[model samples]
Target: VKSQHSERCIDFLTKELKVSNEKQAQERVLFVSARETLQAR
Candidate 1:
């Protein structure tokens, strides 16, 4: 069973955040993760 907000972050990114398609969606996650990784050093 999926929660009410299941995959909601993806929705926000694609809708309100205007991320467009899957490639753009994945890229956004990767970029943010990389930024966090660098900051943790």
Candidate 2:
């Protein structure tokens, strides 16, 4: 990533897409949190 891509690309892709090897883990966390938030309301 450091050698091939620019910093901007990394930042946008990471934050917007939440991409990487841990994508599944991150997605699960996001869904869990959303479910909790909805339940709270």
Candidate 3:
């Protein structure tokens, strides 16, 4: 169940952000999260 949700998130990120590969997707996730964290401060 959790894995399925994760897959969906990855797919959504790939489409929304136009990341071409899994490694890029992971990096994009990190970048987005870091921006969100700074914004939350």
Candidate 4:
């Protein structure tokens, strides 16, 4: 289910965040995940 969640996240990022390219989408994911991790602490 984790893979599905990843796809969903990517889809949401692409549609809502308006990330145009694969590389930017990936970077945005990494950045968002990192920020979430920090916020969890």
Candidate 5:
């Protein structure tokens, strides 16, 4: 039972990490595009 609980915790943490990474990637894309737009003006 203890092992099973730890496995679930690890899984949850991995999922949370993946979500944060995706958010960071999205923010980077947005920043790059905004910079490009500013340069174009």
Candidate 6:
């Protein structure tokens, strides 16, 4: 039972990490685009 609980925890953590990583990637893309636009001006 304890092992099962740990497994679930790990799964949840992995999912959370994936979500955060995706968010960071999106933000980085946005930042780069904004910088490019500013430099173009």
Each candidate's clash count: 0, 0, 0, 0, 0, 0
Cα error, candidate 3, residue 32 (Å): 18
The CA-based lDDT of model 6 is what? 0.49
Pairs of residues at least 3 apart in sequence or in different chains that clash in candidate 3: none
Best by lDDT: 4
Candidate 5 lDDT (Cα, 0 to 1) = 0.48
15 in model 6: Cα distance from truth in Å? 2.1
lDDT by residue for model 5 (1-41), tens: 54565455455545655544434444333212556679999
lDDT per residue (tens digit) for residues 1-41 in model 4: 55666677787878877755556765665424566779999
Q: Which is the better candidate, 4 or 6, if ranked by lDDT?
A: 4
lDDT of 3: 0.61
- lDDT at 37, model 4: 79
In candidate 3, how many Å is residue 30 off? 10
Could you tell me how far off, in angstroms, the CA of residue 18 lies in candidate 4 after the best superposition? 1.1
Model 2 residue-pair collision total: 0
Off by over 4 Å in 1: 1-6, 23-41
Over 1-41, each residue of candidate 2 has an lDDT whose tens digit, in order, gives 33233444555456777775345433434212556679999
Off by over 4 Å in 4: 27-41
Provide C-alpha RMSD values for all models, in order. 6.7, 11.3, 6.0, 4.9, 14.9, 14.7
Clashing pairs in 5: none
lDDT score, candidate 5, position 40: 97
**Candidate number achieving the greatest TM-score relative to the actual structure:** 4
Whole-model Cα lDDT of every candidate shown, in order: 0.57, 0.49, 0.61, 0.65, 0.48, 0.49
